[model samples]
Target: MDNIKLFSEPIADATPVIELFDVGMHYDSGEEILSDVNISINKGEFYFLTGASGAGKTTLLKLLYLAHPPSRGHIKLFKHDLHYKDRDAMAKVRRKIGVVFQDYKLIETMSVLDNVALSLRILGRSEKYIEKNVPSLLHWVGLGNHMHNKPATLSGGQKQRVAIARAIVNKPDVLIADEPTGNVDPRMAQRLLHLFKELNKYGTTVIVASHNTELVNTFAFPRLHLEDGKLIKYNAGSIWTLFDKKGDVNV
Candidate 1:
């Protein structure tokens, strides 16, 4: 823990965008999914959540986007404590965080353009505004020609791109991606990462949960490593490294 402190001192004058203290989650079956997790992710930073299947990566992500409340401990996002159960306050916070799921949770019945514009539409933006922005965002994600196509008609990569376009169309302050490159080719995966990097450069905090070691290593982002539902390692600087329980490092 001291070593973690040594490497994780916050940047001067920068406030953390997300903070978790002794966070834990468990199920009705009394099975612990996460325990004693502590982390702070500052604005504009990028991190890879690397762990095996069932290591609670998705659960932890759910906590970030406010999909679920932790069974214990505290979580603060954008400087607001999640302990406050005010619906209006929570909704306001959620409006600033965009999430991209692994399944590309687009509406199968809606056209790609409609799906991408859903957020703005819900916000009561005018059709004129939606019309102007959706296509441009689609074009940026390489889906310009496919805007009218339904999710059922798009390829895996195309669907992922659509998901990304939808998530960022409103220009949220934080973007959370779960296994974003899971179904794409390596080249497309890198392209997707490049997109995230570009967004990060524009000041969006990005957190990607993935098990793809090659991509994780290649990107050289700081990492939060989970094991058996516990955050065992947090490296905020230097190249990413995976360490086993025996303390053997894999670079």
Candidate 2:
């Protein structure tokens, strides 16, 4: 792990790595999903995206991950305006982001090692590099003994770990996880959060989306709370204070 950077090192005092200004998204029917969303997430910060089901948590993540363009407004990734970046330009930035889908998105046909190694393979990493690092990463995620197993054979928690291993294997600058702990027990959930915390300490900007309020409350990270198509960005204590007053702040 020391030889390989598990995440990119942040530049000192640079602009926010992610920025959204007057962003909005809607379906073909034109009902807005996100409205007037504006926020800036700096490099190496950890944030939790929280909201009720269908409160646009996933939608917001899609925008961050460059899954789709917003129906309107501007987005900047690493200081490149998404609206203007061509396909290749956008892809160049996208590679720096690692996403852990809620569904685990593993290839059942592939062994756990290969599943985790696919990103490296795609990036043209040498087989030797893959062999050396992939197994080591799997071990870090507590999957050392199961590297040869396929996805179908893993327990829910194990599969989640595989997904996480795959996401971080390429050392993405930004790591986005949607309900990463949703399938695991309380103990495992805490363990998984600790892993994310460790990644943040190594300079990866991490954004985790979760509805598990109890788990979220235990952490002191700032939060981006979405409600009724708007965003409320607040720190730990600010959320409780805002909840009591039934108020919201953009920043």
Candidate 3:
């Protein structure tokens, strides 16, 4: 844990994994994207967030992942009030969190194993430790034989799995995935979803966002629906019950 940053201040022993209190986001050009978003993601919870394009799902994820600060309200994670933390402290928080963007942000030049092991190296893990962990994780994600292969050489589903393995390699307490199954076939997409489910079973708080109705409908997890910067809850029988007057998602 040498490269892992220590918190600037210690926590008082009680806090949700993530707590957003009336949080909102406003752009510099006077556009409001999120308004009064108050939610708490407890430890080891699995949640799905689905909405149409530009419905603020990604924005909400960005805030939760600490990519950017909200324009209004407070965010607390692991009992650490983010408002009181500096940049250094934020980095530490990020270390315990893992994220998978829709774009599959992999190093095209690096082999699958190398790319997956990059994060551990960044955290100053010993060479022996990284060597032991990298191949093991690649195999876990079904990429062990392809360790020497780069991203461009892999299939869309394979790339997604590589991204997932990289995200979880550090053993983060939480994982956030945005449109992780968007580019693959239905069967492959289902496989990827199962990977997320398996990760959750291992005690990682998991949140996934996708506009894929058929895909999400197969699972009985709670869903957070978004529309025109507004939020709605998803329940049984139908996932499309929240598109009234606010917004609609065809998927």
Candidate 4:
């Protein structure tokens, strides 16, 4: 707790885009998934969420993306406290956060272009604007040739690319990706990361949940590691703790 104060004290001028304080979660079976997790992610920062297969990574993501409420404690996104009962308010805040699920969650009936264009469409953009920008974004993700193809016709990696393109098209205030690179080759994975990097440069906070150590090590972003239902923030590429009293917070 002292270290949380230390880490937060130096950055008083900058507000956290996402804040979790003494948060905890559980399911119907009465099993606790996370406990007392405290974290604050500032604007424009990129963090890699790393842990084992069932280490509550996805569960934590569900909370961050505003899909579920914590069983205890508090969560604030974009400075608004999460009151899960307020569906309208939750939906409004959700629109400002883009999420790429582990399952891709694409509509099998829709074409690649249509899927990627859905976000812009929901925002009520004109057809002309959608037509002009969607193709260019698809091409950037190397899906130019598959714009008209449906999700059922594409491979796993291709579907993942489509999901990435869609999540980022609206340029939301924050982007959350769950195992975003799981289906792609190393080359394509790096390319996708570069895209996320470009978006972060433009002021979008990014959090990528992954178990891929090689890929995580390739970037110098600070990491939030989940272990035994607790959270620890660490400096990039080091064992030095960011939220422990003995180590300094460099992120």
Candidate 4 versus the native: TM-score?
Answer: 0.87
Give the per-residue lDDT of model 1 (tens digit) for 18-97.
98877889999999988777777888788888899998999999999999899998998999887557999999999999
- Residue 46 local lDDT, model 2: 89
Candidate 4 per-residue lDDT over residues 53-172, each given as its tens digit: 889999999999987789998999989998889888998899889898878999989999999998888889999989988887787777889999999999878898899889878767
In order, what lDDT does every prediction score? 0.83, 0.85, 0.81, 0.82
Worst 10 residues of 1 by lDDT: 1-10
Q: Pick the candidate with the highest lDDT.
A: 2
Clashing pairs in 4: none
- Candidate 3: regions farther than 4 A off: 1-15, 236-251
How would the candidate models be sorted by lDDT, starting from the highest? 2, 1, 4, 3
Q: Residue 222 CA error for candidate 2 (Å)?
A: 1.0
lDDT of 2 by residue, 1-251 (tens): 23444444655554588888878889899998888788778888889999999999999999999998889988888888875448888889889899999999999999999999998999899999998889888888889999999999999889999999999998888999999999999998998898898888888889999999999989989888888887767688764323322223333
RMSD of 3: 6.6
**Runs in model 4 with CA error above 4 Å?**
1-13, 240-251
Give each model a TM-score. 0.87, 0.91, 0.87, 0.87
Clashing pairs in 2: none
> What is the alpha-carbon lDDT for the whole of candidate 3?
0.81
* Regions more than 4 Å wrong, model 1: 1-13, 234-251
